[model samples]
Target: MRKIPIAETLIEKMLFIFTVAGSLVIFFVIFYIFSNGLPVLKASGLSFFTTGGWDGQFTSAWTAAPGQEIWRFGAVELIAGTLLTTGGALLVAGLLGMGCAVFLAEFCPPRLRRPVEACVRLLAGIPPVIYGVVGYTTVVPLVQSLISDQLALEMVRICVLDGTSLLAGIMVLGIMITPIFVILATDALETVPLAYKAASLALGVSHWRTIVKIMIPVARRGILAGGIMAAGMAAGEFIAMAMVAGGVAFLPNPAHGLLFFLEPVRTLAANVFINSEVLGKANMESALFACASVILFICIIFSLLAQLINRPNLKGGRSR
Candidate 1:
């Protein structure tokens, strides 16, 4: 063997060191959050999640302020709110994005692809605050006008059901994440070989059937991966949702149904931002960290799910 090149060895060692360092950093961060958060969880007990009345526990301070003796850390309402907005986003984006992907993959003319692709990229690049502003002005008004007065009054017992509600947040979140789903879905579909499409068509299958039976089957993993990624994106979004969701942590009132989406709600990310700014709670720091941990847990789950669906062994609907 010839002598090893100095540049190659040096570069390899340097990259290896960098990769290990990056991994260590992420590991330490997760470890730190769990270490700090578990004690608070234990002290707070299960009631921290089950009971309502957040102010009752957080209003009192052990140091700077004094009012109550107990600390309330109930996050059930936040969990509910997060799920509602994210679920709504999934519903909206799933239909719209998947439809767009199909249109682009199977029907779009070459001349139009550039413009449409540019628009998708632009949508992805826009700042979350810009979406927040646009939703607050446009979607909010649209929703307010669409709901019947009778339904609004019925929901008022639980929340304002006004311009700023879960519906607005859902719409805003859906629009914000649509580009992500479309891009991923498009990429997934693009991976299928043209020969597969031609073969299916030659077999006397309709163009529609070829896509449904062949292309879609090969691309399902990617499509699912896109959805999971979109869910994760929706989960992490706080600014746009905070603007649209009314930033209220109230649970659905007993009279309100479990599936109520017409009322105001708050997500875990929004709650963390708001509660961290609160001055009354003595354990505010710990509680905020716990909120962060909860979000991290959700993101990790989505990441794992996306990975599981898009494995390298299943090469874009083709078997090696």
Candidate 2:
């Protein structure tokens, strides 16, 4: 046998080292965030979650001047806004995307499916900033004309409100994440065994009924995973939501029903973007990082719950 090349051995060693290092770096970053955020959590206690006030003025004896006091960071408004907008987006995206997935998987011809699937992926490639600009110029004006102007009919003043309200944010986010759900659901639907479909058909079940009852149930786990991913996209979308969510600090009322559509809203990431300059130091920035940690935690919990719900054997049904 020829002598082993030293270069090849070195390259293999380098690649292995780099991969392990990269993985450890990711873990380290996560650990650092949690460590830093713990202070805020402890300071906040239970009230941090229940109360939406973020007063950044506390007196530290070591740092306080004779008459000066300073406090920094606790942003419940941002948290609430982020959740509401993302949740609304998830609702619309999930329904429309799952519906499209069902149609594509069960009804469309293979030739039609290929192009449709390609288009769905293409939608995911569009930039969030572009979505924001479109929302501002087109979507906001339409909302103002159709809804705000109508409300103005009874009032003396006509306000051209922000197009970045909670509803607008939801619609934009829904459009953004729809592709992921559609693609994933479509893939899952395809994996559903043809035998099941045939058996249903042999039993005289309608084509639509077979798809609804048999195909969907089998692919539930994969579809649910895709849904969780879509929700993550919606939740983490900062630039787009920042532009379109009106960035109000106080929470909007869901009980106001459609009023949420008209009013401005803020999200946690949007808050970080807006108020990173608070106190002219990195204190607020660190606080924003803590907020990000919280969002990540929420996403992790949601994914866990989805996994629990979507487990194949949990329903005691056979999966093909």
Clash count list over all predictions: 2, 5
Residue pairs with colliding backbones in model 2 are 56-71, 57-71, 58-70, 58-71, 164-244
Which has the greatest lDDT? 1
Computed on alpha carbons, the lDDT of every model, listed in order, comes to: 0.79, 0.73
**Clash pairs, model 1 backbone:** 57-72, 218-317
As a whole number from 0 to 100, the lDDT of residue 258 in candidate 2 is 71
lDDT of predicted model 2: 0.73
Cα error, residue 17 of model 2, in Å, equals: 3.8
Across 242-276, the per-residue lDDT of candidate 1 in tens digits comes to 88888888775536563355677888888777666
Query: What does candidate 2 score on TM?
Result: 0.82
Segments of candidate 1 deviating more than 4 angstroms = 61-72, 147-157, 253-259, 279-282, 312-320
Clashes of 2: 5
